[model samples]
Target: MSDPVSEAGTIPVNDSTPILAYGPLVLDVPGRPVPLAMKVSAPATGTGLPIILLSHGHGMTTFLSSLRGYGPLADFFAAHGFVVVQPTHLDSTALGLRESDHPEAPTFWKSRPAEISFIIDHLDDIEAAVPGLAGRLDTTRVAAVGHSLGGHTVALLRGMQTRDPADGSTVRVPDERIKAAVIIATPGEADEQTNQDMLNNYPVNKYNDFSTMGMDALVVAGDKDLNPMFSDRLSYRWDAYTRAPGPKTLLMVHGAEHIFGGISGYDASETTDEDPERVSTLRALIWAYLRSQLYPDDPAWNRALAAMGDFGTVEAK
Candidate 1:
């Protein structure tokens, strides 16, 4: 991988490398109500490639929150030498499923992380499903990235805890297979600033304990990503970084919003911050983080930091 230029504060994000993307590779779980559908995208040519499991957010759009969305990211990462796998979770609006349909209908929080692990469990099948992907992936080097509710999923995989109110048991679902993670715009600890109505609806949000998220992670937050529905505090989205233990980094994008300038998809109607430059910078930053995490000696992260002029601020602990 080429190092990012200090002058531009950008990595090689251009679509110079060709890619092969295959989709709707269905996997039928024994007890799941519906089959798990996913998409696989990888550089047209690469061996010993790392894997990135991208989880979609619960967005207002019908399909942006499903496997069909996040083209901007999936394509970018694939073009940059990573096997990007995206799973359409149960909470997606495209599935036409409702909260009354299942006990965890709204977000399917537990099932979300399970879905990621399930994907990792079936890497062989995935490779078999997509042509030219066989013998290309380095399964041991896997990372997870998620946005919004999807970010919550990555946190769980990285060892965040939340209590199950139904049985009064602590629910800590972590997958050791995921070596690292990038949590974007996820909700934080509920406090007096939190909206009572939102908590009442999604009671699980009240128990989000980040103290045990000890894995190497990059938490990306936007300074302007304020949601009254969740909390009035501007730092509501920074909980995963601030509350979690060490070996974590925070990328606070100035004046950004929940979508981080259309990360979910290209020309997405749900994006309030529709700056392409912002989106490009974000993908580069994330690419650098994942690269540095998977390959410690790589200078992609450090180069990105030096070139982060006006893009955002990065702090690690």
Candidate 2:
């Protein structure tokens, strides 16, 4: 695809190009028997580029948990000159591990953030794994981007605390390395009426308190992306943005679903609302946000919001 710098000005994040991908790079977690493995993607060129540590949502099955998920966002970010690192958490169906398998079960909410922190702690090793990628990254300009359940992980690192499903205790584990974040289709305050049982099933759901998210972030949601299992209303997903403090932006897609136009895969059947244009739209918006947030005095965010003025409602503070 041709690299077009139209809407986002400098960040040509929508154009797909040659990307160097290295994966399954095993890193031994301190005490866990299971190692933390991740995949790295680069632009195949460039130096002093920014970094994006991406986390995939706990998908229905293994593929999304593996190194192959989020083709839309991961590939786009790499093409635009950001080194992307994605880690498969222990909760993934790919590993088939459970609460019985280790300690954190159902969803490794606590462990998930630690995994991201681990990756950040060892960025040099990850960067060296990819050929022609040495000294090509600006480690200080890092952002965390996550979708679905993975979105919750980024929030935690950014100061959003959740109740521990294991002990019913409120836990907040923040990593100062994460300067900015972009969360998509992630949960918000627990719905009192609809999520009582869900809270019991996943106690951490009750811990989504947005009182202290004082970091830079962009929350993207879909108008129709309702959580049938946890919410009776469509607005439940908006809690991530609406409830959080300022210095955040909320982009609500006009008529998007959970998958948001096949972002999970190139052509997954889950995309009941398949529209590649929507995928491209999100890519552009996110890159613009990342670009502006990462670099001071950058106007890509202004240009992006102006370009997307007609597509959706972007509430920024």
Candidate 3:
């Protein structure tokens, strides 16, 4: 079988450019048995390109949460002139491990943001690993994008907060280094607006607070993405957009699901709303969003603002 990620072509470029990918970069820390591992991809030729720290969501299998998922978004962003980095968190089933079960199971949630921070801290090392990529990255313009549980992690980087169940105290893990973010199908704050089902899934969601998420972010929600396993109300997905401080944007796909049109995998069966057109539209909007945010003069941002209704309604504040 061809490489799933490589087979999933990049964004359209008239010049016939290539995307350079380097993988399984084992990022080791002192005394850590297995160091953090990730895959890095970027345009074959581009200087001062923005960086995107991608965090994968939790899945039943390891591949989806490991460095193997989100090829569609990763390939497109890399080919379109951004450096993409994805790290495999300890919660990956591939590790054949379970959360401590000590108090809560934000196993992957707690470590997700740290991993992004780590990649940002070690950009020099990461660039050195990718041949001809050194000095081509624009560290000043970095973004964090994630899906499902991964999106929750992205919110944290943008300053979302959680409360410790043990003491009912707030636990904040904010990384101001991330300038912008894209949160796809992430959950919301669960106080009065939260349904009974959502509060039960993860006690942590009940304590989620987005008041401090004042950074520039694009929140994507699926109109029909009613996750029975997570929440009963479809509107629960919009909490990140409504509750978080602006400037923020919300994209609600007409009839999408948690997988967001097989974004987690090339052809995963979980994509109940697998419309290639919608997926393509989503990919384009994100590309434009990032492009516009990083480059003040990129017209894609303004165009995206006007044309967002073609795919879904956009609410910005």
Number of the top candidate by TM-score? 1
Residue 28, candidate 1: Cα error in Å is 0.8
Give per-residue CA lDDT, model 1, range 1-317, as digits (tens).
Answer: 96542211365433448988898899998788899999899999979999999999988789999989999888888988899999999989998775555878777787899999999999998987898888988999999999999999999999999987667789988999998799999989899999999888778899999999888799999998998999999988999999999889999998899999889998999999887778888888899889889989988888888877888898999
TM-scores vs. true structure, each candidate = 0.95, 0.92, 0.89
- Could you tell me which residue pairs clash in candidate 2? 99-105, 163-207
Name model 1 segments beyond 4 Å from true: 1-9, 12-15
| Candidate 1, poorest ten consecutive residues by summed lDDT | 5-14
Supply candidate 2's per-residue lDDT for 258: 88
For residues 1-317, could you state the per-residue lDDT of candidate 2 as single tens digits?
96553323232444556888888788999976589888888887778979999988887756876678887778888988889998888878878775465667778888889999988998888777777888998989889998888889988888897776667788888888887799988877876555677777667877789878877689989998987688887887877787888878999988898888777777877678997778878778888888888886888788877677556788877
After best superposition, candidate 2 residue 114: deviation in angstroms? 0.7
Tens-digit per-residue lDDT, 165-193, candidate 3: 66788777778777778999888766554
Which ranges in model 3 have alpha carbons more than 4 Å from their true place?
A: 1-16, 30-33, 99-106, 191-201, 307-309
Give the Cα-based TM-score of candidate 1 against the true structure.
0.95
- How many angstroms is residue 315 displaced in model 2 relative to the true structure, after the best TM-score fit? 0.8
Task: Identify the runs in model 2 with alpha carbons over 4 angstroms from their true place.
Answer: 1-17, 99-101
